[model samples]
Target: MKRFPNQIIRLIIPFVIIIAGLLIAKKFLVPASFGKLGHFRADALGEAMSKPIHYVGQQACADCHDEIVKKKAASYHKGVACEVCHGPGSAHVDSPTENKPPAPRDRGFCPVCHSYNPSRPTGFPQIVTVTHNPGKACISCHNAHDPVPPHAPEQCGACHGDIARTKMASPHVDVPCTVCHETPTEHRMNPRMYVPTIPANREFCGKCHAKDAQSAKEIPRIDMGTHGERYVCWECHYPHLPQVYNGAAK
Candidate 1:
């Protein structure tokens, strides 16, 4: 019995000593630096990890960021709250220590409400068609802080350099790129802006080719008629402007 008690004491003494050492080390270690030892304070960690907290319910966010709430009001998304598209964010805000906020996946977040049907203009390219990756999120290019699409097609050229260069070489280069490409709220150009109300018709081509239009008026110009559905004004008119418009019918 005496030997058994000594053996137990030896075992417990090591454990007690280890615990005391931990306590002493904790006293010396700063709370902020405790992460170095793999110890994180829930409150501090929560604040540190707070990265705009995906969809933390617009209401809760509005409570703090009323300015954003006011700006977003009366916008297309006003009917929808932060959680409608972002999913549940309360758990993340409340217990972010254990729960990690969902990744900012655009396709996944949008499809929850938007559909491919024509009724939903936002889904035109369809989440799947535009972004092959379902995990892709819309906010990647869009800033929720300033929900309005502030970037124009010129800005889009940053990521779409090839398209931008190609467009620069096209006859339509004179037109501001945004005239054709629009944002979430306005995607398609209004057809009426074209003279013929048809983008491919001769009248549509006359809008900018004022000189050609005047010459054609006096010369009874050739009725290209969209080149028998084979080519449009772009095919004949060099997009590089005066340097490219050689005055040749072809």
Candidate 2:
């Protein structure tokens, strides 16, 4: 009593076939346990459990590496698991001599975490691998296990590397770090314990930048009282590379 147009029938035939194909595929392809645990497969948990466990816990690694574990526990990498760098350690734990975990000795490997990514949280240490001691490995200058919290650095750049590198090419390049930062003698050996004091007021920067200052004329001048009177100099101008602001060089 009812019939579709030839064009309508053409579309309907393919649609029906596609639907039938999908139903057939689902019947044979989908796991039987699917939807048993609300969009999850109940068998998936058992399947995963049946697989050989590749990673032994951190405590297992520490059993034979107590000294290294202790050093790492006190360093910047304290939170980083040993397996993260050394690969799955279960085999090594089971057969210590025969199944040694691979050590990532490649210089390229370090940039995975150390690369200068702006999206990283503020104050997280980063470096541009291409320009930062290009010929050398990271472990050359810094020990991987105990990078900062345990090692006593002889220079400020050892800890404040990004700042030091920026300042190296800045107008204040010749200026001693002590000129702007009243660094304690102990700061070099124990940086975190003895934090250095930074410029607190515009007047501190005005020592050299003030229009009426008794300093080199080649240096840029600004009336600290009238220009940016409310803000500290470093608030708008980073002390490391003060000439640049909001991506423009002043």
Candidate 3:
């Protein structure tokens, strides 16, 4: 019995000392930049993090940003979550001025989740390449929550009135404007949507005008040589007047 008491006392003393040491260490220990367990602590901490400021959910935005929200609702991104595009905004909401979070103000921050490339929410493969700056972030040229498609005409003639007039009356009017001037992509304006191998686009026109083509036996073959290889057939055949033989008429 006497020996048992001594053993119990010894074990309890060490346990008490260990608990005391832990208490002291806990009191003095400063939080790490990423907290005590680093990445391990992130998940638990993330749950407790500050909410967002701007897109206080789609409903909140819909209340104030009615026009923008309406436009976005009609876009391909209607299914995407507001936070998915805007990022967490609790800090900004809690102390909007004191924290002055970047989400509300900058494009770079928006890229974190709403990447310029096809991110999680923007799941469409074609939509991924629809960025002015794919290397940067989604927010660079776009407001992720309220994305807008490019309005600029894909054709060179859009700005060049003379070319526009000539092409409008050219025989090649059947062709799409984007077929020549605009870069090839699944989606317009998105660089990532570009096809790695777009076979000879000019050859498309050759398919129709075999009689006027270089290989044709009828009209003395016009040897454009290097120029023909590089330039589209539409460059010579006015789009507005595709029937008019700009080259040696067959």
Candidate 4:
């Protein structure tokens, strides 16, 4: 081959040197175990395993809190693990004397999970905290372990004894007051001036009285097209003691 020109030789020498330098640097710079486990540092697994465990699980918690676990098991909140509210118990489990788990309070505890999110499943109870109870803790009315508050009728009756009596004697005795009125979680916490809305429309009645509903067969069903269009349901029948009357005279 013809001898390379001085300028060309100089350029080629620098390029070869740069490639050799990169190869040498890569040998020292790249981790030895990197790619040994397919793009992950093999030593990282050992590092992670060496770190202390944080969560000890619900079974570990139940060893000392069997009573609480028992109540939780029977309640709607049975699926919620103890550590979800209580935080990680590994430290506490490791040394019960020194590492005590903090007690969960009402500040932002319950609403963290219970607060109204439209994306939550339909059966999950959710509340708009601001509208429900402005400044009250959830524990005031609801049991922390069993969670489900007292029956609506009894709770409503505790304050509205007269209305409760009237409702108990009415045709709608079996129906819950919450059916027509909404008592948000906040209202249950502090019932100061909370006046539940009494819906006075035919469509409200149509929820249970609509002839189209398959489940409403056991209850009175009406044709809203013909029967209840002219007047509100309460216009003809009393809300507490609904009774069918002849003609629109009432």
Candidate 5:
């Protein structure tokens, strides 16, 4: 090979020296454990495994609070785990006297799962806080362990006696109050002058009675496409007494 020119040799020497210096530094500077687990430190897994567990689970809590567990079993909250609202119980279990788990009395506690989030399943009971119970604590109206009310029908009748009586006399007596009136959870907690708005649109009535092939045949169904779109369902047939003659003679 022909010898490099003096200018080229000067430029090449520094690059070769710099690469060699980097390799030497890498050999000494990098930790021995690094790259043992695909660029992670091998000892990190051991350190994490050595740390103590924080959550003791619902079973561990049931061992000490059998009475509360029994009460919960009979209530609507039976499916909810104790530790979900109570927090991790391991610290409390280890030192029961000193590390008592705090009571979940805050108004915000129940709404964590109960608040009306659109992503939540449609069947889950949820409420809009401002409309449901503006300033009241949940525990004030709802029992902590057994949140569901006992006499719902009677409670509803107390305020809406006229509507309740009309509903009872109507053909749709078997239909539940909640079928038309969404539970006014806020109104129950704190009395309000206005109740939740009742829908009078054709689509609202169509939910149960639309003449879709999929709808239950035992119940009345109407074809909105052919049926006069100008008139609402209640205009001709009173919702509470749909079977009774209330409209003008045809």
Candidate 6:
């Protein structure tokens, strides 16, 4: 550059001034301990330590609640810490007799962890709290300390809960579960080993739906010969909801 052009010099001047201003401001504005060891202020460690510790950890709970703690450890809730639901235990630790940690007993409280959400990790137990055993507290059936079935499932809904909920609102609500799936008594003890039988052919459904079938007159009738020939009824219609199993029909 033989000589600095006025237009170029004007742009350079503002940038230089701004850079100098930022450098000068940083020295005064930033904490003295900032970036001492890393990006964090060195004084931040002391600030956090000054705050009071609330949780005494799980071992602290075993002193008084040994039986319940052992039960929870052996159950599905082994990984869950006690304070996660019960809140901070510092108050109770100082006066164990007087300050009993309040327990969550309401139906709404359990849903915070157990309610159905797609974002939650797969295989995690979830329920549609609105339709799942409505009007009953979760603790009524499930012991909070050791949550497992009290006995073998007496109702199909105990395991096939989603299907049960659908059938509740469907036209087949009055239909018995045994009518569709021929479940054996042994299936209750070992469901995997002793499986239930599904309808093999359309004739099974025709027992209820055929026009001339000896069944309730109020039940909808279909011509088994013409309607859904060759394919089984369940291929198109879900027995529980009594609608198209796949893509929407209505």
User: Which model scores highest in lDDT?
Assistant: 6
What's the residue-level lDDT of 221 in candidate 4? 73
| Residue-level lDDT tens digits of model 4 in 170-192 | 77999898989987655654454
Q: At residue 121, what lDDT does model 5 achieve?
A: 64
Model 5 lDDT-worst window of ten:
186-195
lDDT of each: 0.54, 0.83, 0.55, 0.79, 0.79, 0.86
- Give the clash count for each candidate: 6, 0, 21, 1, 1, 0
User: Which lDDT tens digits does candidate 1 get at residues 1-250?
Assistant: 3456778989999999999999998787747555653666646666768765445557676765588678777554566666654468777667655865554454455555544566765322333435444444667765554444444333646544676777787654656655544434233222222222225454555554444565434432445544434666556544334234356633
lDDT of 1: 0.54
Model 4 misplaced regions, further than 4 Å:
1-26, 37-39, 152-250
Pairs that collide in candidate 6 are none
lDDT of 2 at 166: 93
Off by over 4 Å in 5: 1-48, 150-250
Query: How well does candidate 3 match the true structure in TM-score terms?
Result: 0.28
TM-scores for all candidates?
Answer: 0.30, 0.51, 0.28, 0.48, 0.45, 0.56
For 190-229, candidate 2 gives per-residue lDDT tens digits of 5566789977777888888899999988877877768878
For model 3, how does the per-residue alpha-carbon lDDT over 110-168 read when each residue is reduced to its tens digit?
Answer: 44444445335332333334354556645556565556654634654543467566666
Candidate 5 vs candidate 6: the lDDT winner is 6
Candidate 6's residue-wise lDDT over 54-94, tens digit each? 99888999998999899999886787889987889988988
Task: Report lDDT (Cα) of residue 226, candidate 3.
Answer: 49
Better of 3 and 6 by lDDT: 6
Better of 1 and 4 by lDDT: 4
TM-score quality measure for candidate 2: 0.51
TM-score of 5: 0.45
